[model samples]
Target: MDANREIQAPNSGCKHGGWVTLPFITGAVVGLTLAGVGWTANLIVYLIGEFNLNSIDAAQVFNVVNGGSFVFPIVGAIIADSFLGCFSVISIFSCISLLGTVCVALTATLSSLRPTACNGGSGSSCNHDHPSSVQFLVLYGGITLASLGQGGTRFTLATMGANQFEKPQQQGVFFNWYFITQYAAYVVGATALVYIQDNLSWGLGFGICVAANFLGLVSFLSGNRFYLHDKPRGSPFMDIGRVIVAAFRKRNFPLSSMPDDYYNPITQAAPPKKAFRFLNRAALKVEGDIRSDGSIAKPWRLCTLQQVEDLKTLFRIFPLWSSSIFLGTTIAMQASLTVLQALNMDRRLGRHFKIPAGSILVIQILTSAIFLTLVDRFFSPAWQKVTKKSPSPLQRIGIGHGLNLLGMAVSALVESERLKTVHDQPEPTPIAPMSALWLVPQLSLVGIGESFHYPGQVALYYEEFPASLRSTSTATISLIIGIAFYLSTAIIDLLRRVTRWLPDSINNGRLDNVYWVLTVVAVLNFGYYLACAKHYKYQNVEKEAAYDTCD
Candidate 1:
């Protein structure tokens, strides 16, 4: 089949491609994201206020929830690639999300599902009642369903939307808009829904989320007739496994210089590159390996060169991927800690208005959204004009690493200043006199870094991955983020056990030390990333040109 050909949906007259599906897809993305982020952004606050959890416990729960949300995408992606396609997976998850949101809304409306409010005191000192076992079960059940829904839909939607377009340039445009919608939705959720929850009522806030989710699901279904449905091509993981087994079986086979010595399913393309040469033995044909018709007779003993090359692609990319894990860890830590910092700091913008601690993360989301537009529209084109070629994914990622380090440094400095304010007070108040605005610069810097790396990583994975693993390619970033969030939780636990840097109360803890530690880690990770990028060669140089042309 031609790569550009669109697969027609059964019993649908709507033609694939053009602007017909974009609006509906974009609308669904907006609604789903808005609903998902609305509840999650204020989760720590919700736990502390309604469930009467401690600061540390709330933060840990938030990290775990975020981790679960990201990690679930891998499962969703695999199901899409191996059985049901993206549309089916998304529809099922959307319904799951609605049910979860409804349950959460009921919890807010029914006092029995939440613990009584704590009396005025430091969260550490307050003798607050914990949620009952029944309450805990309901809360966990709601959040678990919600997290699974989010994980299934988030990156899978991006892949689905991109699949509608055949041209890589068109797909690139779709990704830019997809991220723009995602971050913009985060800004709204963190700001508007958070304010409603903080000021009006939790029930009302959660009700809004339920409505948004319903709308998303409905809008997605309404566009089913127009979608280009890709049929499942079986499990990519199994192919990878076969390659490993086949290579081991032919361990003693000597590599030959001629192209014909190795099996090439597509005879026209260049032979597999020399990198990871040991794996090439898997494609080395022996007597009885190929039948009369040129297909493999002993599947476990022989494989096509493309299969071996696909496995090698994963090996080449793993180092770069692993290096990104710590960068994500640093960002996750900053996200959770900044909220705590805001909770303790003076959050008032003026006499009439005060910022919700949970909403402070909106600064990062807003900055990322703005920078994404600028990069897509201005910076990339400007660079191309001067250099005669667009910035490569590795180069964009390198820039992101530099900015991420800068952001961490800024965080350390701001924390140091906040600590100084803590010490200078003659009598400490519950909230410090230092303004929360001091946290904005660091968040903004991180957002700018994200603008560079997030899309770069997406484009890299989509272009490099095996055709059968297209959906999984986009979800790989989600996997990194999920691991990072889990690692962030582990790191926090270790800090609490071993050092005084991450006490429940940020006022007395050496929070500055945490940021400094993250900064150092970022520096080391960036060095490792540089080494990986320098040594790497593009597996799909022509496809990379398509991305460059789009940029």
Candidate 2:
């Protein structure tokens, strides 16, 4: 809490926004992140341990669930932007998440939902018991509902929280805290909750998640009076589609330089930019374009100048957006493979204290949470003080690109060391003697990188995108992540088929080569990002130094 912050009244008015709403919004963020990561962090373990799934089947199910969770945010965002406002959408989805968690908890509690437990002795594989159709239904149905709930609320809350502040700088500051809070909650979920789920009881673990989800819903609604809501102005996607159709229909029309030659809602409205000049024709007014009331006679053939420019903005951003795909893919792959690495190494902390393979990833989340605070408190100020300006969003993203690529390089080196240790070990020694803590540096580097790029990407997309797509803008990251999940699977499969880099026994395979390959790809992607960013122009005054102003 800021010392001088004023408490706003409970009246829901247009002036109700700014720091007054921070508590409620942040509370909701904590709840959602905690709840979402709880089940997700240990999903594969739950499937294999309880449902008697094979490693391959469990991994496949995890991918589907994870991918759905990331991809469904677009659906939530579209509904929020087009019909229900962010508040309604988030509230609705949070309940859906709670419901999903409840269903999962039921599965954990009820005996009928699970298959027979494995009874195989040491050094022998148990014949996996196949679950019945009804069991599968309950499990998958709950997963679907939960994914929908978590996905819809995740980034939509981000957009809503940012909307509380009018200043672009304040929004950026909110984003920083938003991610910090999220990463912190991720640590709790991945470590504490996962331990509870694995050691204590799955029912209790999921029940706690359900409670968290419900708490998030209540916390969000607590600020309803303080929220400055964006009224749904109909489907933004339709507007985007209309712009494309209109532009193509008028593609052959010559763009007129005169301002009056276009259709602007305001009488003296400025003309759209000439960047995508061909798109400007969508706003060009022909004799039959506008009716007596100034509405378009042909909805598909005519669009607002704003709509035309909005489409152009997406077109301009596409290249920079594409560069992030590989980054996301690398992140997904590393997250999955690191757990495997941990499983193969000495994960003991002290006598009788073995680290869970699933929880090893929390190191990354913990590092990100810690450094995000540093970036917010010390680093940004120091940078501003030394350079006479704060780092821009693009500068932050570029730094992240380098740091993340370096992390990949480090992963390769560490894997090489681990492989050498594997070779040095006496015959039949399964687990490598190398401490799993060696994996921490690579993960931490990526975590630190995320502290820069993740928030930077959020702020960049939110500020640069048109007002109509604010919610969708945040979800674009989700969409990118969704795509990357599939790409990661595809890449790993390709490696398995064509090369020995990712054989069944990673200790026998050239695992370091996989990291090196990712590193090379990331470096090339970084170069592409640089090229795009070098030529990219910030859309307006707000986009110019918005991130720096956050400091």
Candidate 3:
């Protein structure tokens, strides 16, 4: 029974406590870089074009720019795993981003060299339509380069940060802190960049971004000694192909076909030479000497190809985290549409003073900072005790999806109110202006949802995937986000066509209709999320073995 219960234990030994701090520093760098490429560049572009581009134009153009990060994660993940490793990949990308930032800032500052229309280029704001073809190429090219660096580092940083705390017991706590800090980075980026763009010159704002990326490079390089520096797996193309083949075989295999006797969990007498044999107390019939927990008390074998294949099979059948895609879309709108919407909002603080519309972004950051304290110092530990069974990372993710629905619902209400006011009034006037305060509920709901979704997804992705496939698994999550961006685009278009009753007068390039559409999507996504939760179950393999033996 002891032999049956004891299989291979996971590689959980690590005495490191401060390894996570390094990533936090690196995360700040990422935050700054994101501000530069994502926020500062946006302001610069708008200023250069010096035109009143509306919400739709801003969302669409930004989507085109943001697409690079989504597309690059797969590349970054593959490279990080196969050759560069996380640290090197992160450093190199930071440096590249710094260069991209410099290029854009210089272009903005050197506007006298080209025609005014081309000053910023053909877009809303640019300096000198690229001075020449070469300048234009260089400017746009710089943006793409920055995207590569940001995307590469963004995908790897969180995973690498989590890697610092390796033990299972510590992993949960470590991840909690890990997620808190990461979300905090977004908060910092959004708030800080918005302030810079609103108050400071665009050149200064972008220069700050460049400096942040440069500092990120320095900080990441400084931490070389403490980091684990694990070798990244190469591209998963071969693995993906193998997975497809195996899936096809499973479909073609006879219905009567049973698992191979040698691989069968029910009849296996001992662990395969390299496979660990763990006793499962959950088994009704104890095939061997069972310990108190009905588990083998010692390690039996190492991992084997067969066991690896079996694990692969387990991964293949795992239910799709379909609802997560919606959560991603919700958070993503902060980057894409939310900024556009804010731009259209009345930024009047009171009489003579008006806040920058972008300044509202601070609300998200402050909210995250507040929530992180509450969750880590209060909610997480307390919830752990109350549940008796520790909350599965995926469950946290599910709750996050629910929150996303609530967030979008709030956003829909605010937009609906704005629409009503605009329709009833002669113009968008201060006397009957839709209160900017309404955006508070929307932002707050998003913050709460983010508190759950981002952290939960990070932990769930890493904990669920086998080590050999970590890079691909992490990258896939980013790819899914990218897909969601395109999906949002499609959703917006569909809403516009479906609501012909809305009249072009209302939608007239405003995102009011689209915001409501997102709300419906969020509600539907929430229902789908519940279904997904019902369909899935988490497998803490180590704990399962322990429980099997004790039972």
Candidate 4:
């Protein structure tokens, strides 16, 4: 077998020096995340403060930008799987990201690129001056390029790092550290970078991001010789397409009950299992399907039983995947709105240090990082000891769904209280009398839910997806997040048109009603998730067993 084929094999040996590339890869992850989140964390504030956009418009822009960031990872994953491999793609996009960050920094430094300040005002009283077309295009161009670069690098980097390890144990360790680095970066970006932007200067803050991007690119390139480069085989998506086409073409053919009748690449194994049996016809032998050399002559007309089975596995998991979309949508909407809420509430901590509105998100990232460690270190093992089996991915995801619903409920209650405080104030102040810390409970609950579901989703996809699509499997989370953000934007826009729930000044609008709607949607989504989870079956039972053992 060729190198690419060997790499794709389940039992492939590690050719490169194991763990040598870990530090470089982890360093790059931290740097890239720092750069990416530095801008993204404070994006809404930047749009409102620098671009002079209204609160609602800024939130919408933030969602769209975040959605794009998530969407581009699928493109990156496809490119990594089909054309340029992960290392090459990461290298190319890293450079692109650095350039984009530089452009963003320039916009902050050069006053001409951004709109004038909103009459030097602090909050709702600020004048809402729209950016000129030229200014808007430049700003958006920078944001777009930066977002694309971030999308291409984030999950693809994880897959590339994981590829260096042959053992499942070591791979698990790498993933733990991978997420740790990512969340740590988010905490720093949300708190430190945001503080700098709010206190010092946007130019200085964005300049730091530019520096981090450059450093990350350099760090990634430095580990070039140590990395095990997985070369691009054809796109896995193409194989999925081929399976569907072949299955449909053979719809009239009858499936055989005997193992010998169906096409199995491995001579020793039994025929594909009974589920989705209609698809089994694609693997049924027909005259002229095979060449004299035993190769597939008409690839589109005939597929291996494994291909057919893999397609079925994807189909089985899709409803589960679809159900997670609304979960993410709720989180996305809550995150954007929480920042706005923080901006309106009293954000003081001590005598001198007042939290930045953008920095309030750091609470969630910090909670997730802490809880993730606790779960990995203590909770999983403890659960296994009590139950005699580690918790399944579906169970963990279900727990996440429940916690998410609770978080939405808490958010609705908090918003209601904040609105009451807003109404009770004798005079209209820029800030509400309520403390920003009230948002922490909902944010922390969301974080804890993430600690369960994010890893569960990644593990489920990685375990269930075919080896050929391993990289793409990891990127699937990004795809869902992207879609959810877009959906959230649409939902927000729809609400604005139809209801009084989300307006420019949330204090003047029924913001709590929006959270209540989300809570209801989340409850329905959880029901859908339960149904999907109960019916779904694992394709690789042995792999899941091994994963459980490793945990």
- Best of the candidates, TM-score: 4
1 or 3: which has the higher lDDT?
Answer: 1
Q: What's the true lDDT of residue 46 in model 4?
A: 87
Q: How far does residue 438 in candidate 4 sit from its true spot (Å)?
A: 0.9
lDDT, each prediction = 0.84, 0.82, 0.56, 0.85
Model 2, residue pairs in steric clash: none
TM-score (C-alpha, index-matched) for candidate 1: 0.92
Residue-level error in angstroms, candidate 2, position 174: 5.2
Q: Which candidate is the best by lDDT?
A: 4
User: Residue-wise lDDT of candidate 1 within 1-551, one digit each (tens)?
Assistant: 11522455754555765467898888889889988898999988888777777777788889999999999999888887778988999999988888888888888999988878755524565445778999988888999898899889997888788778877788778877887788778788889999999889999999999999999898989888888887776668878988899989989888887788888876755666798888888888888899899888988888889889889889988998998899899999889888888888998888978899899988887887789889989999998898788888888888899999999999999999998888898997767789999999999999999999988898788777777666577788999999999999999899889998877678889989989999999999998998888777677777555434212
Writing each residue's lDDT as its tens digit, candidate 4 over 1-551 gives: 11233353322353363688888998899889999999999988888888788898889889998999999989888888888888889999888888888888988999899877876444344655567898888888898899999999988898788888877799888887888788778888888999999999999999999999988999998887777778777887988988888889989988787887777766746877887888888888899998888889899988888788788878888998999899999999998999999988999988899999988888888888788888888988998898788878887888888999999999999999999998898997667899999999999999999989988998889778777667678788999999999999999999999998877788889989999999999999998888777677677777556433212
Q: In candidate 1, where is summed lDDT lowest over 10 consecutive residues? A: 1-10
Ranking of candidates on TM-score, top first: 4, 1, 2, 3
lDDT of 2: 0.82
Question: Mind giving the per-residue lDDT tens digits that candidate 2 earns over 1-551?
Answer: 11112233346444488898889999998888888889888886787677876543455566677778899889988887678878889999999998998888889889888777544311113344678899999999999999999999888888788777767789779977887788788889999998898778988998899888888888989888888776666667898889888889999898888888888885677767878788898898987888998788999899888888889999998888888889888888888778767767998889967787778889888888788779989988998898777788888888889999999999999999999999997784558899999999999999999999887898788778887776577789999888887788788878878997765446778889999999999999999999988888888866565444322
lDDT (10s digit) by residue, model 3, range 81-166: 66776667777777777777777666556664223542322233332232466666666667777777778777677656655655
CA lDDT, candidate 1, residue 228: 85
Local distance difference test, candidate 1: 0.84
lDDT, model 3, position 13 = 65
Which scores better on lDDT, 2 or 4? Answer: 4
lDDT computed for candidate 4: 0.85
Worst 10 residues of 3 by lDDT: 1-10
